[model samples]
Target: MSDIIAHTGSAFRLTLRRAGRSLLARIGCDCPLCGARVAGARLCAGCESDIAGSMADPAVPRCPRCALRLRHGHCAACLAGAPPFSRCVAAFDYEPPADILVHMLKSGLRLSMAPVLAGMMARACARQGLVLPAGAVLVPVPAGRASLRRRGMNPAAEIARALAGELDIPLARAVLARRRETPRQATLDRRARRRAAQGLYVCREPLAGRHAVLVDDVMTTGSTVRAAAQALIAGGAQDVTVLVAA
Candidate 1:
C-alpha cells in the first residue's frame, strides 16, 4: 500500500510538473540547446550555444573514409586496410551534447528531435563535400527484438526514417537483420566488441550494386557500423556510407 501510494504520488507530481511546463512552454519556455520553449524549459541562448560549441568540426584529423582518428585527415589503417564503405559522414563528436541527444532519442523517445539532428548531419555532409549517391538508399541498422522491446523502438531506424523522409530517399527495411542478441558494445573493449559483432548480421535481400547510406544515432568505437557494413557488402551493395546524426 505504501509503495503504491508513493508511486501514485510520484505520478501525480510528474503530471503536475508536465502540465505546468506545457503551459509555460506555450509562452516560449524551450530548452536553450534545442530552442524549444516549454513550461519549465531552461531555454537560454547562452546555454545552447555553449552546448553546440562543444561539437568538433569535421575538419579534425579523422579518417576520410570512416571518420575515425587519422594522423593527418587520413589514417594509415584506412589506407593500408580500407573498409568496404566508400565514405562516412557524421554531425558531431560523440560526446556531451551529442551523447545527450542520443540519450534522449533512445531513452526519452524524443522523435521530434530527429529533424534537428538530421539537418545538422546534412550540413556536416555538405561542409565536408561528402559525396552522396544520386539515388541513394537509407538503410538503418536493425535492432534485435529484445532491444526493441526494452527501448520501445529502434533508435537507428527512427533516426533513419526521419532522415530518409527529409532527404527524399527510399528506406530499405528488408535488407539487413540482426541475427543475434549481442551484449551492448559500449561496455566492451575493442577486441570484445569486434568478436561479439562477428557474424552477427546477415543480408536477406538482393542489394547488388546498390549505393546505400547507413544511418545511426551515434557511433562510438565503429564496431557495430562496420559489422552492418560487412553484411551490406555481402548483399552486393557497391558502397556503404555511414551517417551518425548527433
Candidate 2:
C-alpha cells in the first residue's frame, strides 16, 4: 500500500509541474528589443510601433526598383541598368532598433523573431501597395553550407517559412541553392561584391510560367538577390520580386 501511494504522489507531482510550465508559457516573457514584459508576443506594442514608423519613410525619396534611399532621383545603379528582380520590398531601413532585431535573429540565434519579422514584412508589402501575382511562390535565398553548419539553421529559410504562413503563399524551400561557398559579402567592396555574387546561385527546379518572391533577411549592395533572381529567371521563372526583412 505504501509503494502504491508513493507512485501516485510522484505522478501527481509530475502533472503539477507540467501544468505550471504551461501556465508560465501562457503568461509571457520579456520583449527581445526593449526587455519589456510581453504577453504571447515577441515584441512589446511600443517597440513594434516604433519599428514600423522607421520603415521606408514616405517623405524620403527612394528608388522604386531597389528601395535605396535617394537624395534627388533614382539611384545610379538602378538607373544604369535594370536589375533581375522587378522590385524590392523592405520591411524597414537597416538602421538602429530594426537592425538590432535582425542581428538578434541572424547572429544571436533568436529564432522566435522570425514570425514577428514576417508579420512586419507582410505589413510593409501592404503599405507599399504591393501585390503578389497569382501562383507566386516564396523562395528563400539559400545560405552557404558553412553558414548552415555554424548556425545550425538558415535565418532566411525561417523567415520565409513564417512569411509563407502569413501570406498564404507556397514555399519552395529547395528551389534555389548556392553554387559554392564564397567570402561573406559584408567584407567585400561594391564592385567586388557584385563580381563575386555573379552566378553564385542556381535553381534546382524548373519554374516555368511562375512568379517567384525571393525572401531574405537583409539587402546591402543587392548583389546577392540579383544573382539569385538571375538564376530563377534562367530556370524559367516569369518574374522575380525581392522581399527582405531589413
Candidate 3:
C-alpha cells in the first residue's frame, strides 16, 4: 500500500513538473542549456553553435556502413565485411555536450528535448547526403517490457516519433519487439555482446518490402542495430538504415 502510494505521488509530481514546463514553453522560456531566454528556441545561439561544432567533421571521411569516422577511404572493419544495415548516420560524436544531453533524456526522462535533438539529427543527415528513401518508415528500436516498466517510456521511441515528423516519414512503433529479457550489453565485451544480442529481437509486423530506418539514441559497437536490422529483414523489410543522435 505504501509503495503504491509512493509511486502515485511520484507520478503526480512528475506530471505537475511537466505541466509547468509546458506552460513556460508556451509563453517564454530560457534555453535548455545556458538558461538564457531564447523565446521560441530550445537552445541559445551560442549553445547551438557549440553543438554544431561538436559534429563538424567534414574532412575526415566516415564509414558508409556504421558512420564511424574513418582515416582512409573506408574503415578497415567495414572493408572486411559490412553489417546487415545498408547505411548509418550519426548527428554528433558521443562526447561532452552530446553525452550530457543524451543522459538527460535517457536517465532523467527529459522528453522535451527529443524534438530538438531529432531535428538536429535530421539536418545533419541531410548535410551529409543521407536521405531516406521514399516510403521509408521510422522504426524505433524497441525497449523490453522490463525496461519500459522501469523508465515509463522508451527514449528511442520518443526520438523516433519526433524524427518521423521532421523527416515527413511514418512512425511504426509496433513493428518490432524484444522476444525475451536479455542481459545488459554494457555488462559484456564485443564478441560476447554480439552473441548476447543475437536473436533477441522479433518482428511483430509484416514489413513486406518497406524501407526501415532504425532509430536509437546512441550507436556504440553497432551490435544492437545490426541485430535489429536482421529481424527487420526477416520480417520482409527491403533494407534498414541506421539513424542515431550520438
| Comparison by lDDT, 1 against 2, better one | 2
Which of the numbered candidates is closest to the native, going by highest TM-score? 2
Give the least accurate 10-residue stretch of model 3, judged by summed lDDT: 20-29
Question: What do the candidate models score in CA lDDT, each in turn?
Answer: 0.72, 0.86, 0.81
Model 1: per-residue Cα lDDT over 1-246, one tens digit each: 999999999789767865754564356445626665544323354544454443344445666677765666557546656676777887766676556776776778877566556656765677677767676889998887877888788888877876664565678876789888888766799789878888788888878788888888877667778889999999988889998865
In candidate 3, the residue pairs with backbone N, CA or C atoms under 3 Å apart (3 or more residues apart, or in different chains) clash, namely none
Looking at candidate 1, what is the lDDT of residue 56? 47
Q: What is the C-alpha lDDT profile of model 2 across 1-246, one tens digit per residue?
A: 999999999789767865754564467778878899887435687887787775556777888888877866769878777899998999888998779889888899989888778878988899889999889999999998878998999999999988886787889999998888898777899999999999999999999989999999999988899999999999999999999988
By summed lDDT, the worst window of 10 consecutive residues in model 2 runs over 17-26
The number of clashing residue pairs in model 2 is 0
How far does residue 140 in candidate 1 sit from its true spot (Å)? 0.1
Model 3 agreement with the true structure over 1-246: per-residue lDDT tens digits:
999999999789767866754665466657777888875426776886777664565665677678887867767656766888888888877887657778888888888878767867887788778867798998999987777887899989999988876787889999988887877667788888778789989899899999999999988877789889999999999999989988
RMSD of 2: 9.8
